[model samples]
Target: MADEKQPAVAPAPDAPREVTSKDGSSHEEITTPTRPPGWMYKGFKVFGHELWYASPLFQLLLVSLVCFMCPGMYNALSGLGGGGQVDHKAQDDASTALYSTFAVVAFFSGSIANKLGVRLTLSFGGLGYVIYIASFLSYNHNQNHGFVVFAGALLGVCAGLLWTAQGTIMMSYPTEDMKGRYISWFWIIFNLGAVIGSLIPLGQNINKVAGPVTDGTYVGFLVLTLIGAVLALCLCDVGKVQREDGSKVIMMKNPSWITEFKGLFETITSAPWVVLLFPMFFASNTFYTYQSNDMNGSQFNTRTRALNNTLYWLAQIFGAVIVGYALDFAGARRSVRAKGSFIALIILTFAIWGGGYAWQKDQVTREETAEEGFVTVDWSDGGKKYVGPMFLYMFYGFYDAAWQTCIYWYMGALSNSGRKAANLAGFYKGIQSAGAAVFWRLDGLKKPFDTMFGATWGLLGGALLIAAPVIWMKIQDTVPLEEDLKFSDETVADVAGAQGAADQAVTAQPEAVRTSKEGGGAKEVV
Candidate 1:
């Protein structure tokens, strides 16, 4: 028989539960994991089994499927076309319109999350996506781009609400020890949309694609969006969430929304955002714009474009999982991690843009389509097999994973106050959106390739170089990066050594020792 496993020993009282931060303040650490996941949701007055939401696995699955339905199928499919592959400009315009609202929508996301909770707020966000996809099917299809823009704004608002709540839940739901792991699971599951959506373009071909898409696509996607929205509705209330130990967090709130609004400003002015998050905001916004306009539009053809999305999304899943381990690496200080990330991101950016700059002329070429109203694009390099540009998306996926993971992890580390963290998440998303909106208006809506490429390098380069240093200097963690096992081992050794020394002292004493008690009873002491 295999040796029986030993149960985990509790920490000794003398073991440090807090650390002195860089700012000279003492902060408590999550010395213990939270309550183990029970049933997803407790049912009735008495329950033995947990609900689906109680399981982190289920929650991950739920969010994954939701992302697939909304952004995965509908948005990705539209990127290169409406039908399958019809009009790039029109579709691109529609996308630009949608992206245009991200700043305003994401700005208010936290306040909305606070009022409505994560579940209902995600539902609100998911519903906009449903409407946007449905709009593509209506007569408004190719008639007016304005309607598409309006619909896109709705999606943006919803996205703002959803992302804020979702970030909060992800950050708050897991125990402190699980923070990195939780973020990894989030991206891992969420990107399923890209994996599945990639296959759709393979069968649909550029010629077969249309303005509103085929009837089956509309009805099928509509149903899919609903399913995702429903899943969002099923999310657990953020306030009344339960920990792994079966302990429930109390739900509390400020007296007014006005007070909450005022608090967001303070969060914006804080160290995490002011010092570390700006470059990330610039980088994320520019990347989204680059992907939307230059890379997705003028750079690659239908099939290759789909491949880019597929590879990027698929790779990000791997990247997210990998980066999660990196962030949680034992005994690795934040300073070391930030430096490594900065160097890696900088190299990747150069590889994507600088290395591929030579092939720019051959990489993207155009031809007149059979339809008078449409323009045909060929991202192929005269069948020369240029692989460099395509790989850029893959590198982007990897960089994206690290960037998102570090930012969120850093956010959790810096802000112990839940309100501040929640607001900061909203602020981060909003700034990201706002930046994208600026890019959409400038380079992406109908941007020339040169401008788009220039912005991509400058923005991403700035992010890696600038933000990386800010992270090293200003972003401090209250929790030590030392591995628990190492710390525990040292503690146990010290305790045992002290005990052994005490025993030796006792042994060295006289064989008989006596002490007199003042109260008449005699007690012997050694």
Candidate 2:
């Protein structure tokens, strides 16, 4: 067949060949040394480095100060100009509306802030807050509840934007190693804000109002809001980074509005587990809203508030520093610890919820007795009479602190890798918003027959408690190979095979040269 064509042969898998060196000498294949993953090592280092300077902690403090200053004024405003003297239901509706706005705005603001730099978004929020407080002052002069609600909505929007940005900034820039610790510190400072906020209202002295108590409270908020705004401006810088090519750039790029709207939806679709964790946030916030309303009603006077705040902060500080360090030391795979913490938090929330229910019942009994003209015990005074409420307050404080600590810890742990943190935070806010919306809508429902608001909240919290451990187990079972394996078996085997082939080639080369010399009249087979 025209001098039969030689069949093509494939290279042997074990064959080795000389590789050229930089100096033109022939050498065998070079080996690359094994090294640890950069993300893991760098993540640890980053957590230790840059977490504290972010301003969420300080911003929370400012918001708390401003928020607490207005309750007395708002109460008075509701009663001004003989406005039918206002009832608990009216106040509840107003508060719900306000908080609902806060929840929704916060969710939207967070997404926008993620696309836009935290500094610019937060600074704008602060300025808007100033405008909101000014509107409140204007409302005080006008005596219009509608204007007050509008102002409150504006405040909610501003607060939502700033808080979302602050949270995102904290979550994004830190290393995985320090993420828990840094977020713990964030909560610690946030609790400190509650302490300070509770105290700021003490300075208002609404009982000794120069004009209406509403007027005095509005003035107080105005001053606090101004201070907050100035601090925000000083702390935030929107346009700061410059590229190597000499082009100025913002720290974050703003995405299209459509992208911002889709963030929550995208997160839920991508991470179904995120949806499961959201109910806990919602339940916790509902409890908080109820407690705030109770406190504002003077159910737990100033001293009680101070004591509760102090205890809460103490527990938070302890949990964050001590428990956070423990989690770090227990190694990176402490899914079990996160589960346990979540369970403990849920138990504590139940205790708080039960205590709140009991407290409400007691208040109703006292009101009924007073209405009947019966001499009631003044348990607000000393010793044994006050012990029950004091015990409740203290326990509630502990519960609040522990619950929040566990929440931050769990979130940090669950969202330790990939793009989980951003997704988790966004979904958490959205779920909390959904819960608030439900509760707000339900507040209009008439009762004494039956209602599901409290029961639904309690059930949601209980479900989350049960779900945490199961989820933790699943996470542990499906631990990523990249995270757990020191080296891939296949990769190691391939490397070993290459080395064996190299050794065989090295051993065979001299014999082949010797044979060639003998066959070619003793000439060297160079």
Candidate 2 lDDT, 139-173, residue by residue in tens: 44665566655665665566566655555545533
Full-model lDDT for every candidate: 0.58, 0.45
The 10-residue segment of model 2 with minimum total lDDT is: 241-250
Weakest ten-residue segment in model 1 by summed lDDT: 481-490
Q: How does candidate 1 score on lDDT?
A: 0.58
Best by TM-score: 1
- Per-residue lDDT of 23-49 in model 1, one digit per residue for the tens? 664443323322233342224221132
In order of appearance, the predictions have TM-scores of: 0.73, 0.63
What are the clash counts of all predictions, listed in order? 14, 2
